[model samples]
Target: MTMKIVKTLFLKAPPEHVWKFLTEADQLALWFHRGAADLKEGGDWTLVTNTYGKEGEKMCWGKVLEMKKPERLVHTFTHNHLKGVETTCTWTLEAVKGGTILTLVHDGWEKYEDDPFGMAANHDSGWDEHFGRLRRVAS
Candidate 1:
């Protein structure tokens, strides 16, 4: 089974504006997490999430595999809970009449086999919540 998590949402902003929220450290922290990144191909990035109380902060690190300003980005993602397991995340943005359509694809879970910890589901819900915040920030 090829496991993947996909989500799409329309934001009330142009692709350029939305791109900043995805790439800039301060802007990302407002909607997603506290972290910084170079945002270029092969650049390293990190995000520290404080949303899970008692579990403290969880750090996710990745390297940018591809980047096209205001259009698309592909990166390798991994976190502590996954014990160095790596996956790919792609984000594509399209301009529309009212806003930009953002599509996110997080794939490569088949590498984890049975996924006894359900990390994919946790990330699915996490993206949903973060996207909601992203919408508000972009509005």
Candidate 2:
């Protein structure tokens, strides 16, 4: 298997608008989990949610690896709940006729000694949930 969860979405918003939802703490919470802080290259980040149990409990944590404004972003990521495994999340945004084409490539499941495929399946569903929210908010 390729060991990656790849998804592409068409957002009815400009690249700049989509960028904020991905990087800004407040903007992120509008769609995905609330970010601990704005994401920037070379900086650490954590996504937390107050819904499941305790408030501000971390869902994911990672370091921003690379970013090229309104275009590309790459980060080292890991779900805190699935400890001992780290992966990478890469996002690419391309301007289109009416909006932006956003692509996500989440990989690095090769590190999972126990159940890589199962984890990939769970994450695939998780991303779909977030993406659905993003589409609605960004519209």
TM-score winner among the candidates?
Answer: 2
Write model 1 residue lDDT over 12-129, tens digit each, in one string: 8999999998888778888888765546677898887656672335488899999999899999988877777899999999999989999999987767655733878888889999
Q: What's every prediction's RMSD, in angstroms?
A: 2.6, 1.2
Estimate every model's Cα lDDT from 0 to 1. Answer: 0.84, 0.91
Model 2 Cα RMSD, 1 decimal: 1.2
Best of the candidates, lDDT? 2
Look at candidate 1 and give me any clashing residue pairs. Answer: none
Let me know the TM-score candidate 2 reaches against the reference structure: 0.95
71-131 per-residue lDDT for model 2 (tens digits): 9999988876467588999999999989999999999887876888998899899999999
Worst 10 residues of 2 by lDDT: 77-86
Clashing pairs in 2: none
**How do all models score by TM-score?**
0.89, 0.95
Error of 2 at 78 (Å): 0.7
